[model samples]
Target: MSLSGETIRKIREAIKSAFPNRDELVMMLRMELDIPESEVPDGSNYNLVVFNLIDQLDRQNRIPELIKGALNERPGNPDVQKVAQEINAIYSNLSDKPLLKSFEFDVVTVNAQGWKISRKRCRAQYFTEDLGNGVTLEMVAIPGGTFMMGAPKNEKDSFDYERPQHEVTVQPFFMGRYPVTQAQWRAVAALPQVNKELKPNPSYFKGDDRPVEQISWYDALEFCARLNFTINVTTQRDYRLPSEAEWEYACRAGTTTPFYFGETITTDLANYRGNSTYGNAPQGEYREETTTVGRFPPNAFGLYDLHGNVWEWCADTWHKNYEGAPKDGSAWINDNDNPILRGGSWGNLPVLCRSAFRFYDSWAERDSHDDLIGFRVVCAFGRT
Candidate 1:
């Protein structure tokens, strides 16, 4: 594909941002292109380094090869993969043959005692939504499946609200790869308001990559509404909060264990309070603050931070139990004013972070902002 000067400039800026470390840049260049160490530029000027590397790759007609190498080497780095996907989209637009894109990742599991059980490779398809100003949102395709949607009675720390361990059939849908980050929140907040006005910076921890907390359930709805309004013009897709069933099914990722990782969770796997341990798991560090999204391993479905970081708001209204929950993967709604919250938060215990754990705030407190609250988005299939 022939990249114009403007396209080249954008790619250079993206590459520089994705790889700011001089050593990492040189390592990628040497690993991808097999460039001799002496020939590579050495300096703190990442722009110059990226410029030379891109120039070399363009001259050799090996830009695509470099992108592939980056994807393979840094699958967890969303910025790198975002740049690759953007370039691939450009190539697809200009050529008859489109480049192959993959979302391969490593899935790890632990036993009841929190011991490592297994590790396997998995892959899923995803699409990127450009939110402008170099920030993008990644939505992974969750496969349709039938799974038990709640905690087993014998499970430790299981609650009545998570009881009845009934079966639920969830249809295929797309979900955010991580909890909504501050950068993503800001981008969508800047969009023309759909209902309520959003504060540009509402998070307490304060990092562009950290999950946007202090967001009420209503604020999350507005974010989705604005996003749908903006993207539906071109894609005709509806973006909204995930249903309670869909949230549990996606978080479990076809696992019956308390966590997608296995029987127990530790501070190493999630961002909950580390002073408390789940099952036989040992106590770990209490970071006392939110870490960047995707700082931990993802589930089998390629979704990250589903266990902790912040509680994710769901589309369902607060219910006492699964007595009359929906069998199909749709939100259970009624005249209730309170909304359901899932996935626990950084300040919660490991038990609260369990996959089947469910929580809700009072109707009077529904609009109140809590630093422990945030959300991710879901897009149904066939909307386009």
Candidate 2:
């Protein structure tokens, strides 16, 4: 590898000190420049020698203030000067004036998997891309394991479509922590796509922090396309909607129940109807619109709004039964282009809000932004 600017500059200085003639020093360093970094032992000696030089010059009372003044003129040059001063102080405190031997040191470093730091150099790295605005998207670390994916057919409010409870193994995937917001949508809308359309002035009921509604399945797909491009996730695995099984599995966090909270759901538990005393107990506010995401408690898996707040978009095509559904958690195909939507909306009654409930919408139709239709995102791991 090529030498860093700091290393190259030091070699130039060393050559100057040894040869005295600038032309001869330049020729020597040019020859040495091709040497591999691994072959350079005492690579750190450059810093130690500079520190020692500053100490010697100061002790001799021969420090040229002109040189110090020139260094001070550069903006960040004080950092170097500060280290030089620290070295001089250490020299004065030591029994012997050997800067390297006299200095005491301790270094600590912490790193994640596949990365490490040694001395002043870092060894391994994986790129992290900023999704946009103030948000950054990083790879989520999920260990490979089996999770109970679908609800049983006999469960309360269970639909035939959720039948054939299966154990699916998800091999470590990354997902967006929050539902896609208006700002993220606009970020994608700015891209060039004729079929990709968005609200002229996208409005969230609560705010941009509230999940962006009023987007169609087609529009959401386009947004994912731009998002995939923005973060450079694999184009082969498009960031489409999550399947019914994946959504429930993530929402449940490995629990088997009618609601993640338990058999009954309350306003305190989720943002659903609470005021009307139904078959359960006391009722809550008769809110006609969707509440802000994360307004209530999250499930065991740290997923928010899986119960209420708003209905989320699913990738599967609508199906009346799960008799022949994919056991591997892939989306089941719907007639023509109709896609399945899941998680009952805010306006929905208590019976409709059950986790097993299934809904469908035409892919071409746009979301009403009625504060009842919001969305989350899913991405295949290692691919995108």
Candidate 3:
């Protein structure tokens, strides 16, 4: 990606203003590109080579203004012939509407070849629509942000595993509004699995709306991989389990309370242990099984069933505490054998549903016995 000619001109002016002398500006620009000064002039020197170098810099949009400023100022000892030649060479390289910045400031869509780029707003738009198989799935658009990932020591209703809250920054992404349901699972499993062992059980919960359970992490990964291929997205961040940090962050939205809805969870709010209550709430309904997604109001971020319905898998490897965890949203997958799990199960007490709750399970293992374990997937924004 390159900068426009007008932007290049402005950049040249800025550089000249800052450096004053052409020779000095040439040396500085060379230093910036990590190119040696000895390689210029006879071997691409300032008088002979700087214009093209500045052009390249402008194309990259890294320090265009800086280079432009240097070029605009005509040195008293003019090398007019060399300057004109260099300028002509560099000018040809400018694109019609070049993109200078390497890092994407805003979301953008590029062609499959990854050449053309277009600004993308509403990178993700969620919906709840029937899959035409008598099933409905809830989807959410998750904007990226930075937040404390793990539970703090003083975190109320937090488990020992969730201690020592750590900061985490996540890139924008999209997530399913709720756990995958039994109907969705069966539909996918019915397809011939390359590995027969990976096939889902027919006897598992079959409700079209109820969250799916008895699935292993490996199974979920395969589903996500298939989905990614099907969607044909350019993003390397595929649809997969949310990291442990991401789960809690999404669950809490922005609240410090035990649950996303605040301190209390009543029967009308979520599905959890009926006998147990949090935040002075009356007992809730102990459904003893997963409920339909979006049965309750969504959190501030418009995510449904983040606290209850089923225990959701996260990408992080299990750790005793948040000590020495990564500040980024990436899972701590180093030398660890167990992946983290978050959100309380349908059978869990309200306290377990707290956003800070955390648990561990073998990554290569399965949660076949637990009817309350399920998963949702995430994809980078604009992937769809």
In every candidate, how many clashes are there?
0, 6, 17
Candidate 1's C-alpha lDDT? 0.81
Off by over 4 Å in 2: 1-129, 135-144, 147-150, 204-206, 233-238, 276-279, 361-371
Model 3 per-residue lDDT tens digits across residues 107-179:
2222322222444322224644233246544456666788776556665556766766667887766678677
Best by TM-score: 1
Winner by lDDT between candidate 2 and candidate 1: 1
Q: Write the per-residue lDDT of candidate 1 for residues 1-384, one digit (tens) a residue.
A: 467897677767666665677777668778855777787766667777778878877887777666655654564566655666566555434322112246889999887677777899999778787776799888888889899988888999899989888999988888999999999999988775557899999998999999999998889989987665444433434689999999999999988989999999887789999898899998888888899999998999999999989999999988888998889999998787788889988999999999999987563246968888899999873421
1-384 per-residue lDDT for model 2 (tens digits): 132345334433432244444343234323433323232322235554444433443454423221222222221343433433332333223232111111112211212111113222212111233544464332222234576655676675566666566677655444455566665666556543424556634655746556677666666777776554323221222356777777766666555656655555666556666564324445667676666665765554445677776777777777666667676767777565666667676766655666666776544234434456767777663421
Better of 2 and 3 by TM-score: 3
TM-score of 3: 0.61
C-alpha lDDT values of all predictions: 0.81, 0.51, 0.58
Better of 1 and 2 by TM-score: 1
| Model 1 clash tally, residue pairs | 0
